[model samples]
Target: MQKKILLSYIVIILLAVGISATTFWNTGYNYIEDENNEHYIRQAELIANAFELTRFDSANDFSSFTKSYADKYNTRITVIDLDGEVLSDSEVEEQLENHGDREEVLDALRGEKASVTRYSETLGTDYFYYAIPVASESFTGVLRIATPFHEISNFNNSVKYSIIRAIIVCVIIAFLAAF
Candidate 1:
C-alpha cells in the first residue's frame, strides 16, 4: 500500500510538471510574437511616413539613412517601387527581383498596410514583416521591415527551460520534505 501511494505521488508530480511546462512554453511564445509584431508595425509606419529619398540631401544617401535604422533595430528594411522593383535594400547588395508579388508588398501596393510572420528563404530564418505604402512626395514606394523571430523564440524557450528546471527542483524539495 505504501509503495503504491508513493508511486502515485511521483506520477502526479510528473504530470503537474509536464502540464506546467507545456503551458508556459505556449503562452511565452505567443506573448513574444505579439509584442514584437506590435513593435515592427509601429516602426514600419514611422519609417514609411517619414521616408524620403532626398532626406539626406540626395538619393545617394538613402543607403546610409536606412543602414542606421537597420543597425539600430536589428531589422532588414527594403524599399520597393510601385512596380515591385527593390530600390534599396539593407540586406541585399544586388538588386532583388520584383517584389510586387510578395503578399506584404502586394498589400502595400494596394494602398493598405499588411504584415506577416513567416520563414524567410533568403535569410534562412523566420521573421515578422510589416509593410506600409509611402505617401511622401519625395518618393512613392513601400517600406518593408522584417524583424527576426529567432531572438524572441530563443528567449522564450530559455524562459520555459528555466521555469521547468525550477519546478523540478521545487518538486524534489517537497518530496524530500514529506519524508
Candidate 2:
C-alpha cells in the first residue's frame, strides 16, 4: 500500500536523522573539550613562565601579584610550595590545606604539565584546572590556574539544544516528503 511505503520511508529517514544528530553532538562535544584543554594548558604555561621570571619580596607581594593576574583573567590562581604549603591564593586569603595530594599538583611536582576537571572543596565548585612547575630565585613551587566548569557546560547545552531542534525540523520535513 502507499500508506505502508510512506510509513517505511519516514521511519528510515528518522533513523538516518537520529544517527547523524548523535554523531554531530558527540563530535561537537569532543571538539569543545579539546579546545578548552589546549586553551587552559597554554594559559598555565604562560602564567608559570611569568611567575618564574619574577621574585617577590614577601608573601604580600606574592599574593598581590597572583591577585592581579587572576582579576585580569577572571580565574582562580594559587601558588603552592614544594612542601605543599599554600603560599598564596588569588581567591582565598586564609592559608588552606596542602595541595600535594591533588592529582594535577602531584603531576606538576614531578615536572609534568597536568590538567583536570573536578570539584574544588575549598571553592565549593567544579573547575577546569591546569598546573605547571615554576621556579624562581625566591620561590620554587607549582602554579595552578582554574576556570569555572559552567562555561563549558553552558556552551555544550546550547549545542545540544540546537541539535535537538534540528532533528525535530528534519523529522517534520521527512514526514512531509514521504507523504
Identify the candidate with maximal lDDT. Answer: 2
TM-scores for all candidates: the values are: 0.85, 0.92
Q: Write the per-residue lDDT of candidate 2 for residues 1-179, one digit (tens) a residue.
A: 98888878987897899889889888988998898788778877888888888988999978988998898877889999887788999999988999999999999899888999999898888999998889998988899999889987887798889889988988888777776
Clash pairs of candidate 1?
A: none
- lDDT score of model 2? 0.88
Q: What is candidate 1's lDDT per residue for 1-179, written digit by digit as tens?
A: 88888888888887877797779778877887777778778877777655753454455566775787788777899888789988778987776778899999999999889998889877799988888888565668788999787876777678778887898897888689656
Off by over 4 Å in 2: none
